[model samples]
Target: MTARPAKAVSRRPPRPARRTSAVRPPRAGRGGPRRLYSRVRRAWDRPLTAYYLILGGSLLITVLGLVMVYSASQIKALQSGLAPSYFFRKQLLAAAIGGVLLLAASRMTAKLHRAMAYPLLAVSVFLMCLVQIPGIGVAVNGNRNWLSLGGPFQMQPSEFGKLALVLWGADLLARKQERKLLTQWKHLLVPLVPVAFLLLGLIMLGGDMGTAIILTAVLFGLLWLAGAPTRLFTGVLGGAVAIGALLILTSANRMSRLACIGATDPGPGDQCWQAVHGIYALASGGFFGSGLGASMEKWGELPEPHTDFIFAITGEELGLAGTLSVLALFAALGYAGIRVAGRTEDPFVRYAAGGVTTWVMAQAMINMGAVLGLLPIAGVPLPLFSYGGSALLPTMFAIGLLIAFARDEPAARAALALATRKPVFGRKPAGVRWKTMRRRVARRPSGER
Candidate 1:
């Protein structure tokens, strides 16, 4: 019995240990997950559709500006006993500064910009007031609208005023929309009318009719976007026309300027001297142009060649073809800006974009119209191409804002990726590999469960 018991106790080589499945770490060299993740991130950071149009238009205008600046300033510089590059140098410097501002503006967040709206408006108002102070404001070309800080550095509050009004209007409308209170005129008028009148009044005090008109256009565009009542807007428009007409009629200078709008021979020493010369410049440059730097009108004939009359310089140098090209550039800008407003899903962003676009396009049309004698001279400079620091800087910043909105467009983002073909961030994520595991789980028998 003992022998049998001992034999039974003999350990059978611990029944060859039952094998159990062990979870294995992910396979090596399978970078498929990492690669897939990167692809997605790159797509998300891409820009929107309107960006290309803006970029292209900006480049063309800048190049044309450089050429026109040289052409327009050659005679003025020589006459002033300064270097032949005087105006060109100043223009280039302004363009450089404006370009920096433009880039910086493009990177700003919409929220940050909206926050800045009120402060900016306040500052602009203060500046506008400063321009009225006896010694502080310098009268230039019969308009007491400029504040000369120092050598070639002047401050035109009206230029910044346009931006302020836009941002303010957008902020106001956005707040109203948020509270569901924008439907009534009272709610809208509380913030809109007073601010607009204040802005318009300030510019009017300086006798800057051009800036005032642009401001009015911006206001109308914003109100339309804000869904204001049609009757209210029509009333506002009619009132604006009446007030403008009264102002023009009351001022001797303005009256004379208006009377000369279509006069062929303004006669010597008339208020129409500048307008007449502008036409002469355009007429001299038929289709092709007189050739770059060969403008006869810039020789003390066309006053303000580098400022309010820059478009005439373009015609004198680049000719009708060049003028048309300039127009095309502006058209491109309008198209891109309109596209940004259309594509944005956010209401504040859309209104802001539209307002900025309308400001520039309207201003451009006004400047061109004045040059063509289709409208009274408003003293507005052409965007980017004009050689004024104040106008150029704000305009460039506005363009940058438009570009920022365009960058947010979906198609532009996609195109950015396609063009660069590089990841904007570190890498995108690869989807989890659950298919194989799911199949394995399904294969398990119900009994096992």
Candidate 2:
């Protein structure tokens, strides 16, 4: 009876029954993958994303290359009875000079770029021709691609030829497109393809198959962006491949390199020495690497550890992580260049960006491929990530071209203008030209308002 009375005294409302269904509304901003995807899309959609990516990626690669260069070149320099900092200092000076060129290029208008195209081409062709002369041309590692400036400094006209081809080809295509000539396949291939082959011919004369390959990539990129017909593109590609194979077969040196692809031994006369050593360097570099300046491969074990084989040295010193970081940076730069090319309304900008991207990406792939034993060692330095000043300068200038194109985008221009308007120095914040406003207000009595 007491228990019944106590139960009856309880007057609280019963709790709502729990639903058996497990489904529930998604929490706001709680969609893990979808939210991440949305955030990434927003970030990529920003107007200045490409500009920042191009600038930041190039700078990072250059800076990292400098460090790697110094580290990798020290022993080589010492063995040569030179200062350990010799290569580093030279590369640093080139980077400094290249910075000026980049700034100038990034500031130039598209019209200015077009105007300089012919002049640049002429200069590059002249220099490349000079590289063929017996006394004037300096031969390095059996490739007569270097020109001595005076004492220790040398230049590679082939590198400049790459930039020239991009600019000249872009201008040529842009003009043809403006004249409505690209619709005809002949116009698309005529001068551009012919001129590119001419440059390739010059590079091949220097025994630089690698540079020729890159130039070919730039040519194809230009044609592709110009909307070449499938048949035309394939015909051109097949012809280039045939020519390349024929050239490789004829040269004992080139054939030797081809034979070294994926080689594990040094072969007769140590023909595959560099290739096998490169693999050894990479294999020695485990996940995190042996640590910076700690690579055994750099200590006389690997040739050109700071140039063509720098990627292997990088792997040995900084490990797989460092190599991947370099790759990611290149990928970001390439993606940004494509974005610039895709987003631009200007024909010149589109073609130029695409060509430059192709040149750099193709060169990078070839260099890294050789290092990884997937390709024949082409003796081409890693763009912006190797020791050679000749490679670094032109590559940096190309990067600057991407920056200029990115900045030329309407949205990017607006964003840049807005950024410049922000207050800095001792100046007041935006919307408040405090001093000037105060002076104007003070000059006009309060009652005047």
The lDDT per prediction is 0.83, 0.91
- Model 1 residue 239 lDDT? 95
Encode model 1's per-residue lDDT on 113-178: one tens digit a residue. 799899999999999999999999988877888888888678898899999998888988988898
Candidate 2 local lDDT, 1-449, one digit each (tens): 45544455667889999989888888867869878988999999999999999999999999999999999999999999999999999999999998998998899899998998999999999999999998999998888988999989899999999999999999999999899999998899888888898899999998889889888899999989999999999999999999998998899999999999999999989999999999999999999999999989888988899899999999998999999999999999999999999989899999999999999999999999999999998888899889988888888888889999999999999878756654469665644333453332222434442
If scored against the real structure, what TM-score would every candidate get? 0.82, 0.89
Cα error of candidate 2 at position 435, Å: 22
lDDT score, candidate 2, position 236: 96
Which TM-score value belongs to model 1?
0.82
Model 1 residue 235 lDDT score: 90
Q: What's the lDDT for residue 127 in model 2?
A: 95
